[model samples]
Target: MTNPLKKYGDARKERIDQLAAMSDGSVAVADAGTIEEAPGVSLIASAWRRLRRNPVFLTGLTITTLFIFLAVFARVIAPHDPAIGYLLDKVRPQSNPIPGPEPGFPLGADNVGRDFFSRLIVGSQQTLIVGVFATLFGLTGGLILGILAGATSGWVDSLVMRAVDVMLSIPSLLLALSISALAPRPSQWTLIIAIATVQVPVFARLLRGTMLQQRSSDHVLAARALGIKRSSIVFRHMVPNALGPVIVQATIVLATSIIDAAALSFLGLGNPDDRQPEWGQMLGQAQQFIYDDPHLAFYPAACIIIVALGFTLMGESLREALDPKSRR
Candidate 1:
């Protein structure tokens, strides 16, 4: 019947094919350099290049990298056996003994004669372990509690927020001390749990406020209008978008977590085994000898300070980098 509609469809198809062919030819002629200028690749590459240019970020990154490496390779890097005490050279300060010294003494020795250097290295392991686990536990607990509270307002939100407020009112150190004392000995699991509990309320309040702000955004309204499941929208869309601040906060929390764990260990509420050469234990055992061989306390204390500062700097750098207002 020589239909007009059939002819129009065939003409459109031919035009599309011609356009596609022209596009392919253009692409081929543009060369590899042109193709490499794709938006996603250039954006990531530019960000990486910019990151390399920032001196503060680079310095923080280097310090953080070294600590992470040491934390991972503590056992292998440690020179002297952490557990073994060099009793023959006990309480020897930084001052070297006679020229032909017996067994070459290190920065003195701890109360039990453990190598202070070795103990410091080993302590990194416990500090890293507790910090990572406790931060994860607290972050997860906070996210869940926050979502539940914010997603459903009214009495549920009030109750959850008030509970967080109560937790926040108590001093973190005291709360940790009471909890550690009441609970079983500070095994890895117990310490992790204790630190997590103490830190969770802070994260909860932070996340709840962020989530509440997000809940009223246009995208959230659109999602609701489109009949998207509330759970999927909150967990997938909302949470991911609001994660920038949370991630920055988490890093700072990690630093604080390490300090808290060390404090607990120093107070003797940490790991049960006395043989384990934790930093805090070394410092605690060095109390009497502070005057005799200050290095005994100072060495471990210095290690803690350095590691904590590294984390703090990294967190600050990350927050600065991620925040648009901060950049301006």
Candidate 2:
């Protein structure tokens, strides 16, 4: 009897050839406009087209760009020195005071009479820095671990996955807090590392799962059958294909990292200097006079919320765009 599997494969190949021939005939009869619109549209290009039309994506992109600009030009744009405060004003009686939105101080002054607007402008730099670096650290670590686990099998995969599981078992905030506690002093780098440590297992697990799915796909199997090096097959074929979810996750993680960093700072695990104009530290200080000057708390809290919202909107939009079901 003829081999069943070989016969099935031959039949499948013949069917594919017939489909190709049909497609060619259809293309030949198609209008020029239809052909032009169909051929050049790649996955990324199609996604971009979809994103451009999405109002949520546009809003997020605008807000994110504005924050980035504010972070970059903080020093040039800030009206006054953020560190200096009006001690003279602080010395005055509590009943009589210089109120907010005063001349030269658009957003008014903090409890110590520091320019609230300037502090907010400068604070964006520190907040963005922490979010960005922490995300980078986490993404880098996760990519390495995910690739190692997904590309291998048996003991190697088990070992890496077990470590990921252990990390995941811990509450993220608690894990970050524990790590930050180990630092001798509250520092920016310490906060970044702590947040990043919490984030690694998340990204690693996501990428590893995606890679596992991709590895058994026809393209990966073909590459392996072609005698491609294992490293090339994994990196060149597997990683790139699995990166869509990772990129989307990175944006969401960035927002979380910023919030986590702010929480760390609020808990007094930030810079030792009270004068530093980080948003979380500012909020920490404002809590003492919350009833007295709610705006002090409001401004920083608003900034944090707006920034995080921007990242979240963008991440969600990207997720929708990348989803195959959404395309259909």
Clashes of each: 1, 0
- lDDT by residue for model 1 over 1-328, one digit each (tens)? 7989999999987887776677746554325356354445543354456667777667767877888899899999987777787653543445532112135445444555556666778778877888899999999998888777877899999999999999999999898888888875567677778889988898888888888888999999999999999998998777877777788889888889988988888888888786666777667777876775677778788878877787787777777667666752
| Candidate closest to the true structure, highest TM-score | 2
Runs in model 1 with CA error above 4 Å? Answer: 1-50, 86-105
**Cα lDDT, model 2, residue 21:** 74
User: What's the TM-score of each model vs. the native?
Assistant: 0.79, 0.86
RMSD of each: 9.2, 9.1
- Encode model 2's per-residue lDDT on 235-260: one tens digit a residue: 88899999999999999999999899
Local distance difference test, per candidate? 0.77, 0.88
lDDT of 2: 0.88
